[model samples]
Target: MEQLFSKALSVSVRCRDSEERKSTIRVTIDLQLSPSAVHKRNLHVRLTDDKDPYFLFTLSISEEDFQSLKAQQGLLIDFGSFPQKFIELLELCHSEQEAESPRFLLQLCSQGPTPEGPSSLSVVETNAFKHLNHLSLRLSPGSDREVKDYLASCLARLKEEREALELRLKRTEEDLSRQLSCTQQTLCEKSKELEKLRSEWTSQTSSLSSRYSDELQSEREKALELQRRLQEQADQLRQELESAHRSSSQQLRSRVGELEVSCRELTERKYKNESAIRDLRMKLVAAEEEGQRSKQQVLSLRRDNSLLDSQVHEKERALSQLQMRAAVLEQEIKDKELLMSRTKDVLEATQQQKVSLEENAVGKDAQIKKLEATVKSLSEELLKANNIIQKLQTEVKSLVGKIKVKNTVTVSQEKVLQETTEKLQSAEKELHSSRQQLGTKEQQMCALKEQLESTVQKLNESREVLKTNENVISWLNKQLNERQMTRATAPEPAAAAAAATSGAKSPLYPLGRATLPPVGGALSSPADLRPTTQLDVAALDSKYFERVDSIPIYGLTSHLPKEIPRPAKASLPSAYFSA
Candidate 1:
C-alpha cells in the first residue's frame, strides 16, 4: 500500500554533536536549491532490517564537515520529518504489529533530528544499538538505581582513602620531629666545643707555675755566690790568697756549666710551649669555621622549617575546607537518597497505573470486537430471512394458481403441509443456536467484570502506596529543614560547648553550666562566638569608654569615662543595635 500510494527518493543525512561546536539546521524550500518539484527532500525515514542495503540512505559528507546536517531531533533515526511520512514509515517498519509498536515508533520519530537542506540526506551510519545504549545511559540518571549505589560506594572508598592519606601525613610529621631533634643535638655539640677550648687554655695557664718556681731557685743561688765572692775580695788582695782564688775559679766554672744546661732545657721548653699555642690557635680557627658553617646550616634549617610550617598551615587549612565540603556532600547524599526513594515510589505508582490502563484498553478492544461480530452476524441473518420470505411468497402464489385452475387442492395441500413442516424445523434450530450464543456471551461478560474488579483493587493498592509515599516525603522534608537549621548555626553549639569545657577546666565553674539565657536566640555567627578575651579587649576601646559614664551598665559601673573608642574590629557576626 505504501509503495503504491507514495513515492520514495534518495537523500543525504548527517548529524554532528560535540562539546566544541553546536549547530542547528533548518530547511529552506527555495526553488533555486531544491530544483526538483518531486524532491523527497522532506524525508521521513523508516527503519528496516539493518542488514538490508536499502535500509540506509548513504550520505557523503566531507571529512572536515563541521555543520550539523541535522534539524531539531524528533525521531530515533537521528532526524525528524513531516508527520505523514513519519506515520507511513512507522507503518512500513512495524506492519506486523503497528498497534503494539506505537510508542517505539513515536520515540523513533521524536528523537530523530530535524534536517535542513535540499541535498540528499544520507542515512546515519553509526550503530543504532550504540545510540540506543547512549540514550539509555543518558536517561538512567533518574531510572537506574544501581548507578546511585555505585556512586555511593565510590564516595565511601574515597573517604577511606582520604583518611589513609591523613595518617601518612601524621607519620611524615613524626619523622620531621626526629630530624629536628638531631639538628638540636648537633647545635649542642658545637656549643660544647667552645667550652672545651676555654678549659684547655685555663689548664695551659696553670702549667706555667712550675716554670716560674724553677726561675726563682736559680736566681737565689746566683745571689748567694755573689755575696761569698764580695766577702773574699778584701782577703784576696793580701799576700798568700792563691789557694782561695783557685777554689773560687773552680766553683765559678761548675756554676757556669749548670747555668748552660738550664738555658738549653728552657729553650726546648719554650719551643714546645709555642708549638702547643700554635696548635690551640689552629683548633680555634677550625672551630670558628665549623661555627660559621653550623650557623649557615641553622639559618637554612630555620628557613626550611618556616617554609614547611607554612606548607603545613596551608595543608591544614585545605584539609579543614575539604572536611567541610565532605560534610556538605554527605548532606547532599542524604537528600539524593531521599529523592531516589521518592522516585521509586512514583515509578511504582506509574507502573500500576499503566497496568490498569492496559487492562481497560484490552477490555474496550474486546467489547468493540464483540459488537462488530454481532452486527455482522445480525445483518447476514436478516438478509437470509428476507430471501426466505420472498421464496415463500412465490410458492404461495404458485400453489393458489394450481388449486384454482387444476382442482388439485388435496395434492397441493399435501405439498404445502410438507414445506411448512420443514420451515418450522429450520426456525426451531436457529432459535436454539441463538440462545446458546447469548449464554456464551453473557459468561464472557461476567468474566470481564471480574477482571475489571481485580484491576480496580490493584489500582486502590497503588493509591495507598502513593499516600504512604507522600507521608514519608513530608516527614523527610521536615527532617531536612531541621538539619539545615542546625547546620547553619553549627558554631553556636560548638562554641557553647567549648566555653563550658574551658570553665570546667579552669575549676572556676561547674560542668554543664548554662551561661546563655533560658529562652535564647543568641547570635550564631563566628564573631559572636569569638573568644571572650577578644570581647573584653574590644570593650576597653577608647570609643567604648567615651560614653561609658552616660551609658547604662548597671548603676555600680559608673567609674568609666564619658566615652572611649569603639572596638577596633566590628567582627562579622556582631550586629549593632540602636538604643
Candidate 2:
C-alpha cells in the first residue's frame, strides 16, 4: 500500500449527465510516502490535458481513511462501502467549482491483477453517487511512458502556432513599408508641379508689368505733347486778343476825337451867324425911317408951290430932283431885304448840323459800355475755369497717393479708375458749359469775330485731344480688368498643388491654402512683381492729362502769360471827349 500511494498515479475525473454522456477531465496525482506519520499523507492532484499547468489541488487523508483506501486497492472497492470517506476526499481535491451536481463513479485499478483480471474496477452505489455528484476520480495508468508522450505532443503544437503568428506579423510590416514609399513618391511629384506653377506665375506677372509700363509711358508722352500744344495755342490766342483790343480801342479813341472837333466847329458857326442876322435887322430899320422922312418933305413942298405961283419955273426943277432921290432909296431897301433872308437860311442850316453831330456822339458812348460789360464777363468765366482746374488737380493728386498706398490690392485700383472716370466726366460737362458761355460771348462781340473764330478752332482741337485721352483711359481700364482676371485665374492651380502637397512633411512642402511661399526660396521680395511702378506710371499719366484739361477756354486777361500784356478796359467816348 505504501509503495502504491508513493508512485505517480493517473487520475481521470469524468462528469456524466443524466443520460450517462462522459466528458473526461484528466489529471495526475502524486501520493508521496510519509516517513514521519503512518496515519496521514498529502495527495497532490494537477490537471494534465488543460492549457494551464498550475491548475492543481491538494488533499490530506487521515490514518484510518488511508488504511481503508490501501486495504481496498487490489480488490473491487465500492464507494458505497465508505461513502463519507470518499466524499470528503473528493471535496478537498475538486478544483472546478463551476460543474453542476451529477452522478460520480470512482474506480481505482492497480498495476498487479488478481486471478479474475489484470485490474479490478470499483463503482459507487447509486445512493452514494447522488450526494457525490461534484467530482468523479479514476486512477488507471500504471507507468510514466503515457504522460511523457502526451506532454511532448502539446509542446510541438504550441511551437507550430507561434511560428504561424510570427510570419503573419512580418507580412503586415512589409505592406506598411510599401505604402510609405508610395506616399513619398506622390509628395515629390506634387512638389515638382507646384514649382512649375510658381515659375509660370512669375513669368506672367513680369510680362504683364512690362506691358503695362510701356503703355503708361506712351500715354504720358501723348499727354505731354497735348499739354505743350495747348499751351502754344493759348499763347497765340492771348496775343491775338490783346492786339485786337488795342487796335479797336485806339480806333474808337480817334473817332471820338474827330466827333468832338466837329461839334465844336458847328457851335462856333452858329454864334457867328446870329451876329450877322442882328446887323442886317438894324440896317432895314434905318432905311424904313428915311423913307418916312422923305414923304414928309414932299408934302411941305406941294403946299408952298400953291401959295407962290409966280416963282413956278424955279420950284419945278427942285421937285424933279427930289423924286429921283426917292427911287434910289427904294432900290437900296430891296437889296437889304434879300440879304436878311439869306442870313436866316444860313443860321437854320448850322443849327441842323449841330443836332446831328450830338446824336452820333450818344450812339458811340452806348457801344463802348456794351463792349466793357462783355469783357468783364469773359474775365470772370476764365477765373471760374481756373478754379475748376485746380480742384481737379488736387483730386488727381489724392488719388495717386491712394494708389501708391494700396498698390497690391486690385480692388483699390478699380476704385481709383472709377473715380478718375467720374472726374473726367465732370470735366467734360464743365467744358460743354464753358463752350456754351463762349458761344454767347462770341455773338455779342461782333467787332472781335476773327478772334472768336480762332478761339473756337482752338477749343475744337482741345476737344479732340480730350477724346483721345478718354480712349486711352478706357483702354487702360480694359487692360487693368484683364490683368485682374488673369490674377484671379492664376491662383487656382497653385492652391490645388498646395492641397496635394499638404500630406507631405511640413519641412519639405511648407505651402498651405492660406500662404504659399515660393518654392526653393527663389523669390526675394514682393516688389519684383513691379505693380507699384505700373501704378505710378498710371498716376502720372492721369495727372498730366488733367493738367491739359485745365487750360482756360476764354483767355482771361488776369490769367494771361507774363509775355502777353492784358488789355485795358475801354472808356466811354463821352468821358474821353470831356477829358
Candidate 3:
C-alpha cells in the first residue's frame, strides 16, 4: 500500500508573484493518492479514473511560510516525500485552536526525545530517518529562548490588529443593517402595488362576466316569450277549426232525421192506396201499374240518401286534413324556437371567449410591466453590490498603503521597529485576503446579472407565445361567430339547432399559460411594476392549478436572485491570526 501510495503521489504548488507586493500570495497545493491509501485513510478523494490518480487534498498557505518551509533540510526538503510528522503537528494545532484561528509559527525539533506536554506550540519530530544521525538534531536552549521572545512580540501585535479589525467590523455592521432595512422597505412597497393590481383585475373580470351573463339571460327570456305566443296562436286556430267541424256535423244529423221521418210517412200512404185499389175488382190492371211506379220512386229516394251521406263524409275528411296541417305548423314553430335558443347559447359562448381574451391580454401586459420593474429593481441591487465591492476594494488599498507607510517609519526603532514591521506585514496579508473575498463577491454579482438577463430572455419568449395564442384564439372566435350567425338566419329550425349546438360545443377561448398581469392596472413607474407580478401569484390563489381560475391564466413565477449573506465581524482578525 505504501509503494502504491508513493506511485500515486502527485502534488503541485503554485505561488503568486511577490513583485506586486500583494500581501497574501496564494499557494495552492494539490495531493493525489492511490486507491489503497485512500481506503485505508478513509479520505474523500476525487479521482480522474479508476486506473488514474486521485486528488486527496488542496491547501492554501502564505508565501512566507512556503519559502521558509522550502528552505528547510532533512526529508522535508524532498517534495515527493510524505511529511507525516508535519501533518500530525498541523492536526494537533487545529485541535488545540478549535475556538480560534491557529497562529503562524516555525520551530525545529529532532527525533531525540518526545515532547512531554500538551502545549499549543509543539514542533513536529520525524521518525522515518533513523539511518541519518544529522537529520535527528534538536533545537538548542538559547535558540528556544529567542524564539519564545519573538513569539511573545508577535502575539502582542496580533492583539492590537484584532482590536483595530473589531472597530472596522462594527462600522460595517451598522452600514449593512441600514441597507437591509432600505431593501426591505422597497420590497414591501412593491408588494402593496401588486396586491392592488390583482384586486382590480379580479373585479374587472367578475364585472364583465356578470354583464355577459345578464345579457344572455335577457335574450333567453325574449326567445321564450316569442315561443309562447306562437304556441298560443296555433292552439287558438285549432280550437276554432274543431268548433266549426262539430257544428257542421250536428246540422247534418238533424237534416238526416227529418228526411227519415218524411220517407216513413210517404211509405204508409202508398200502402193504404194499394189496399183501396185491391178492394175495387174492376180496376185490377191499373192498381198493378201504380204499385210498380211506387217501387221505382222508393229506389230513387234510397240513391239520393246515399249521395248525402257521401257528401258529409267528404266534408269531415277535409276538416281532419286542416287539423293535421295546423299541428304540423305548430311543430315547425316549436323547432324554430328551439333553434333560436341554441343560437343564443352559441352567442353566450362567443361572448365569454371575448371576455377571456381581453382578460388574458390585460394580464400579459401587467406581467410584462412587472418583469420590467423587477429588472429595474435587480439592476439597482446590482449597482448597490458593485458600490459596496468598490468601497471594500478602496478600503483594502488604503489599508495596504497605511501598512507600507508604517513599515517604513518603524525601520529606525530597532527591536520594536522590526517587530512592528512584521506586524504590519501580517496586517497587509489579512487585507489582501479580504480583497480576494471582495473580488469573489463581485464575480457573484456578475453571475446574478447574467441570471437576470436569462430570465428576461425567457420572459420574452413567453410573451411571444402568448401573442401567438391570442391570435389563434381570435381567429377561432371569428370563425365561430360567423358560423353561428349563418345558422341563426337559416329557415330550417332542425338544421339551425344542429348547427348552433355544434358551434356551442366548439371551444370559445383556448386555454393558455401566461405569467403576465393585466394592462389597465399600471402604476406610476412601469419598471417598478415588475415585483407586483411575483407578489400577485401568492395572493391570487394558493392552489391555482386545481381551481377554476387556472382555466384562464397560468404563469411561471420567476424567482428573485438570492442575496449574499452578511460577512462575519471577526473574519479580518481571524485572517490576521491565520497569517
Candidate 4:
C-alpha cells in the first residue's frame, strides 16, 4: 500500500545580487512524501515545482529525524536545529571554486525562532526525484513587540485618513443642502408661473368658445332660412305640377275615347271578315267532297269499259266455233262497243268536275291570307297607343321622384348642421376637464414632495438611534465577557453556585436567566420563549421579571439563540442592556 502526505509551507529565499546586495522573496512550497521510503531508513522528498527560480539550493534530512517523521507524520522538524547539516546541503549545490572565490561564494544563514512558534521544515515528494527528498526553509517574523508597533502606526494613519474623509463628506453635504434649497425656491416660482399660464389658457378658451357659439347661431339661422325657401319653392312646384297633370289627364281621356271607337270599328270589320272566311272554307270543303266523288265515278267508268271489251272478245270466239251463230255474235259485239263509248264520255265529265273544284279551293285560300294581313295591321296600331300611355305615366313618376330627393337632401343638411354644433360643444367640455385634471395632478405632486421630506427626516433620526444602539451593544458584550471570566475562575463549587445564583438576580443577567438552560439539563429551543416588549432600564433592578413565564431576550429571539448556545458568550441588543 502506498501512503503519501503533502505539506504546504511558505518559503523565504534570500539571494545576493551582482552588487552584493541581499534580497528576499517569499513563495509557497508544496512537499509530498511517501511513508514507504521513510520506513526503509531512506528519506525522499519532492517539491511541487522542481525548476523554481527562487529555491535553487538543495536540502536533506538526517536518518534519525526521517525515521521519527515516518513514525509520527504530524511531527515538525526544524532545519535551524542542525546548522551543520544545512550548510553541507548548500555546499553540495556550489562548486569548490564557486565557494572559495569571493565572486561565487554562497552565504546561508539559519533563521532564529519567532514569537509565534519555532520555524519548521516539511518534506515534499516529486516524481522527478524518487530516491531523494528536497526541502525548502522559511522564517517567520521575529518578535511580537515590533509587530505591535507596526500595527499601532498603521491604525494611527487610518484614523488621520478617516478624519480627512469626514471633513470632505461634511463639505459635500453642505453643498448638497444649498442646492436643495435653491431647487425648492425654483419649484415654488415655477408653480406660480404655471398658475398664471393656466389662468391665461382658461381665458382664451372662454373667448374661443363664445366666438364659436356665435358662429353656430348664424349658421343655424342661415339653415332655417334655406329650409323656408325650399319649402316655398316646393309648394310652387307642386301647384304647377298639379295643373299640368290635370290638363294631361283630360287630353289622355279624349285620346283614349277616340282609340276605343277605332278599336270597336276594327273589331266589327274583323268579325265580318271572319264570317266571310268561314263561309268560303265551308264551300271549299263541299267542293273537295264533290271532287272525291267525281274521282270515284271516273274509276268506275274505266272498269266498265274494260268489262265490255272482254265480253266482245268472248262473243267473237263463239262465232268462230259455230258458223250458224256468227250473225248473233256480230250484233252482240256492236252493242258492247256502244256501251264502252258511253263509259269513256262519263269518265271525261268526272275529270272536268274535279279540276273545277280544285280551282275554287285555291281562291278561298287567297281570301284567307288577305284577312290575316288586315288583322296584323290593326294589332300594330293598338301597341303604339299603349307605348304612348306608358311614356306619359313614366314622366309623371320622374317628376314626383325629383321632389322627394330635394326634400330628403334638405333634411339631411339640417341634421348634419346640428351634429357639428354638438361636436364643437363636446370638444369645449373636454378641454375644460383636461385643465382641471392638470391642476389636480400638480397638487398631488406637491403633496408627494412634502411626504418625501418628512420621510428623509425620519431616516436621519433612525440612523442616530442605530449608532447609539451599536455603542451600547459593544459595552454589553464587554460586561458579559468580564462576568464569564469571574464565573469561570471561581474556586469552590459551593461558592461558584452561590455566584451563579447571585448573577442570575443581577440586571446584567436578566436575559441570561430566560435564555440559559437549567443546571445539568439540555437547552430548550427559542420557540418555547414568548416575545416581550423592550426592557425598561429604570425597572431593571426592581421589576426584572414581573411574570413567571420566560421572556425572550431582545435580538436573541431569532436564530442568534441557536447559534450562540453558551449563555456566557451570547450578547443581547442595547435595549436589554441599557440602564
> Each prediction's Cα lDDT score?
0.51, 0.55, 0.51, 0.53
Highest TM-score scorer: 4
For model 1, what is the C-alpha lDDT against the true structure? 0.51
Write the residue-wise lDDT of candidate 2 on 236-348 in tens digits.
99999999999999999999999999999999999999999899989989988998899889888887876677567568877887888788889889988998999899889
Whole-structure CA lDDT of model 2 = 0.55
Model 2, residue 378: C-alpha shift (Å): 99
* Clashes per candidate (backbone, < 3 Å): 41, 1, 11, 7
Alpha-carbon shift of residue 511 in model 1 (angstroms):
39
Compare candidates 1 and 4 on lDDT and give the better one.
4
Off by over 4 Å in 1: 1-425, 491-579
Best of the two (3, 4) by TM-score: 4
For every candidate, C-alpha RMSD to the true structure in Å = 67.9, 83.0, 70.2, 73.6
Model 4 score (lDDT) = 0.53
Model 2 spans > 4 angstroms off: 1-142, 186-579
Clash pairs detected, candidate 4: 31-124, 32-124, 32-125, 45-133, 46-124, 46-125, 46-126
Listed in order, each prediction's TM-score against the native is 0.15, 0.14, 0.16, 0.18
For 266-287, candidate 1 gives per-residue lDDT tens digits of 9999999999999999999999
